[model samples]
Target: MPAYGLRSHAWPVTHAVTELIAVNAALTPGRELYLSLRHRDSALRIVVWDQHPRHADPDTRALCEARRSTALWLLAAVVDDWGGEWGSGEARPPQQGVKSWVLLPQ
Candidate 1:
């Protein structure tokens, strides 16, 4: 995907990368993931899409977390330190997947 208006800030970049990894891990073996970056509403928005419409079950998520505590911790740290917002939900429109996104102040 094409990227635009991305900044060089370390925390946002780190958060984005970690989020991408999380999305990739959540995808089924043969499925694909999509990414989008944009500047909007005075913030930088980063989104990652995966083929699953619903989030993984708690047990599954916990299993993944156990294997990826560092990256997930870093992602959480950045969002908490920077006061940014992040979430995942059903994708819009005819899309058949989930969109995980982060909005960091510019």
Candidate 2:
């Protein structure tokens, strides 16, 4: 992916996924895709924010998976159930959650 060439396929969201991609593409050296997202749960409300959208239409997500899995599952993964082997055991540390999951028939 070229730095100057990403403006065409770039998708702008609340936080700048495109800018991150551009910066990574320009500064980093590899053919990998980078994804960033945030999910927050407050006393009253829950918020989910993502950067790259599944479809270019930007209307609906084909799956309920979060942004990391969505990018992996849709763009870079060789297999359908990519990134599925990440351990979801109870051994997760204090700061990080063990794993994320989706429980629906897609």
Candidate 3:
């Protein structure tokens, strides 16, 4: 990622990726996870995929709040943009998983 001029964003992006993997590993053992970093145009994108799409129910404010109170918040703070999606049809080949991504200016 640093090779793409992301040296300044690498640490925080790596931390966010690590936390996402750790959280998924701890909460959903035996499931597969994937991490991807891409540099396009003038931006760097970091994405983490885990096989737990419905891990948190956004309909429940309390649960959402609890889930948001983690490294994800810090990730959002450090990146230019960040978001997540629950579905198997995005991020990679068709599969059941959740995709969390952060984008930083290059």
Candidate 4:
């Protein structure tokens, strides 16, 4: 995996990423970061999760077909921070497929 770039509290977003990595690593040994694209370059996919799954946008409610708010903005921020085009996808649990994506520009 690429090294965690910049280390400055001024960049809360970057610092948050580092903290998330550390927490995940501590919580789940060998599973530090949720996404790892060491294999190759390709389009990306992202599936966010939350306990409550409904939304103010009736359209999104229909689109996601979810239960509570899924923090879509936060998801986008993460993807943008990581330099990738963002898109939505359904996540079927109890064997939901993978949870990472690649967004190669056209």
Candidate No. with top lDDT? 1
After TM-score superposition, what is the CA distance of residue 14 in candidate 2 from its true location, in Å? 5.5
RMSD of 1: 4.8
Error of 3 at 17 (Å): 1.6
Instruction: Tell me the tens digit of each residue's lDDT in model 1 across 1-106.
Output: 1244444555576657676656455554578877787777767777877676344698876554454345455666677677787765667877667666777776
Model 2 ranges off by over 4 Å:
1-15, 42-106
Q: Give candidate 1's total backbone clashes.
A: 0
lDDT of 1 at 98: 62
Indicate whether candidate 3 or candidate 4 has the larger lDDT: 3
Q: For each candidate, C-alpha RMSD in Å?
A: 4.8, 17.1, 5.0, 8.8
What value does the lDDT take at residue 58 in candidate 3? 47
TM-score, ranked from best to worst: 1, 3, 4, 2
lDDT of 2 by residue, 1-106 (tens): 1243423222222123343354334322454442434232311111222222234343333232343444433222222232212211111343221122221111
- Residue ranges of candidate 1 with Cα displaced over 4 Å: 1-11, 53-73
User: By summed lDDT, which 10 consecutive residues of candidate 2 come out lowest?
Assistant: 42-51
Model 2, position 67: C-alpha lDDT score? 38
- Per-residue error for 87 in candidate 1, Å, reads 0.5
Could you give the candidate ranking by lDDT, starting with the highest? 1, 3, 4, 2
Candidate 4 residue 34 Cα shift, in angstroms, is: 9.2
